[model samples]
Target: MFDQLIAYLDSVRARDPAPRSRWEILLYPGVWALGFHRLAHWLFDGELYFLARFVNHLSRWLTAIDIHPGAKIGRNLFIDHGFTVIGETAEIGDNVTIYQCVTLGGTNPTNGVGGKRHPTLKDNVIIGSGAQIIGPIVVGERARVGANAVVTDDVPEGATMIGLKARSTLVPAETWLREFIPYGTPCDEPCEQGNGGVERVEALERELAELRAEVAALKEERQVPARSRKTGAAS
Candidate 1:
């Protein structure tokens, strides 16, 4: 227990620029969530499922970070900021850094009774704020997911992923670790689409949807007339 506390403190001190003291670290959401998670995970492993859930609920209420008791999380996991969610079947490895509003969620909500639904993030992976890693995909060690990106496919080790489509560019994990990119990518890199560009695309998409609806209505109208003509011929 003493070692775990020290490790958690050390991890927070090393990763975060905010908290000045160990006392401050204790007040952080990540520390509180992880502290409760340890006890909850122990209860869950012992098959005390209801008790585990009760503990988890309390933790969520207090921290606003929801990490399921069933999730397999390793040491030095840093949940930066709050509102981070780690799903029931999600597997997280050691030294993972997750920013606020990140979700390691399940893609298929229905049909499957019990199986791995969420993603598996290997050691040293960094998930930026608002990133959603859905499905049973594997994010290999030292991979990075950019903010607001939605990743559906598996990410290779040392890869840097970005955008809504989750495009990846590979870099050696060692080299990536040596230099840190604050928001998962350098500031100089151009955005895939600016706000104006996005708005224009959205407008075009709406127009396209209206056109498709109009075409569908025409097709239905033509089919109805054909059926009526056949009925008249038979009569």
Candidate 2:
């Protein structure tokens, strides 16, 4: 009973939603989330459509957190910051940690009757800020996804995923975290923009787009205007 209580407390603490507030709002968010998770999980199992969506709508309204009712989350699933998103097909094991802005989505077509999207995280996995783990990949147990890493592939157990497309390597969480600055910027090369990789990638992507636009403009100007076929003149 004590173990169960401790597990529940851990679960609540892990998903604390209040930030920039004093002690008052600190623990309340987690309690609310616990109640919400319970409701959402129940709805998922029972496939109660209207009630599930209603509860999810209310939960998102009250909490910035948005977790699809179809997602199966195990015990001690803490969500810090509340901007975290878990897809409908997402399967979360026990003792998972999801920070703010973490996205577990599916790249599969989001068209009519959306296909199976969203990644599954096994037990004791920690997903950092802005990390995107998409597709039908499986993140192994005790895996730590670095802040802002974009992961689209399967992750092995006890691995640390970092950088664009998320490279898995054997590294300690403390060591990897130490390489990131306090403002969430990564100390590494490609991940230098935000304590994580996505920021840097976004920067690079913006620069590439600008360069492409410039090249296109130059090419357009170098070419002559459309020629009048009858007059044989370039206008």
Candidate 3:
């Protein structure tokens, strides 16, 4: 048990540079929240729903992180900072790193039956702060969700999702091969190819310029005809 704890702390240390020691990592709200969740999950599995909810509520009160007792979390799942919520039926695989203010939220069922409503995150996935991964989507292994992204679809393996209504970024080969990227966003210039918003803006600017030129030509033609008519009238 102590060995497992050490390993978990080491995993968090690898992802976060702020922690000075294992002791400091131990004091993190995320760590305490995970501990409470384990007990709550056990109770939930044993059909003690009330007790599981009780533990879950207590954990939320103490840590400011809400994790449903029915959520299945795998080993070394790290939640950096707090204000994160994992919904019921959400499945998180090993070494998944979730940042602050992220939600593993669910969609409302159409048939009034609650099945797998929440998302399933595969191993080594990283979710950036304020990311909303909604519905029964499967975020594939090594997938990265950028900060403030709203993902409603299944993410492919090693894909980096960014922007509102999240679209997949074109990750360079070098960036894709990297083991870790802070906040799931690549800092390199090559990764800018995925910025479709910039391209769209440039296209709009070109169209506006063309429209202005056409308007100027039409005005010049009309002015020439008016000048010719005035000269004929004067003659």
Index of the highest-lDDT prediction: 3
lDDT of 2 by residue, 174-230 (tens): 655442222123333433444557766688999999999999998777664432353
Please give, for residues 54-86, the per-residue lDDT of candidate 3 as tens digits. 999999999999999999999999899899999
Per-model TM-score, in order, reads 0.75, 0.64, 0.80
Ranking by lDDT: 3, 1, 2
Comparison by lDDT, 2 against 3, better one: 3
Whole-model lDDT, model 3: 0.95
Score candidate 1 by lDDT: 0.87
Write down the lDDT of every candidate, Cα atoms only: 0.87, 0.72, 0.95
Which candidate achieves the best TM-score against the true structure? 3
Q: How many residue pairs clash in each candidate?
A: 0, 8, 0
Give candidate 2's error at residue 178 in angstroms: 14
Q: What local lDDT score does residue 29 receive in model 1, on the 0 to 100 scale?
A: 91
Error of 1 at 225 (Å): 65
Residue 103 lDDT in model 3?
95
lDDT (10s digit) by residue, model 1, range 95-115 = 888989999998765876869
Query: By TM-score, highest first, what's the ranking?
Result: 3, 1, 2
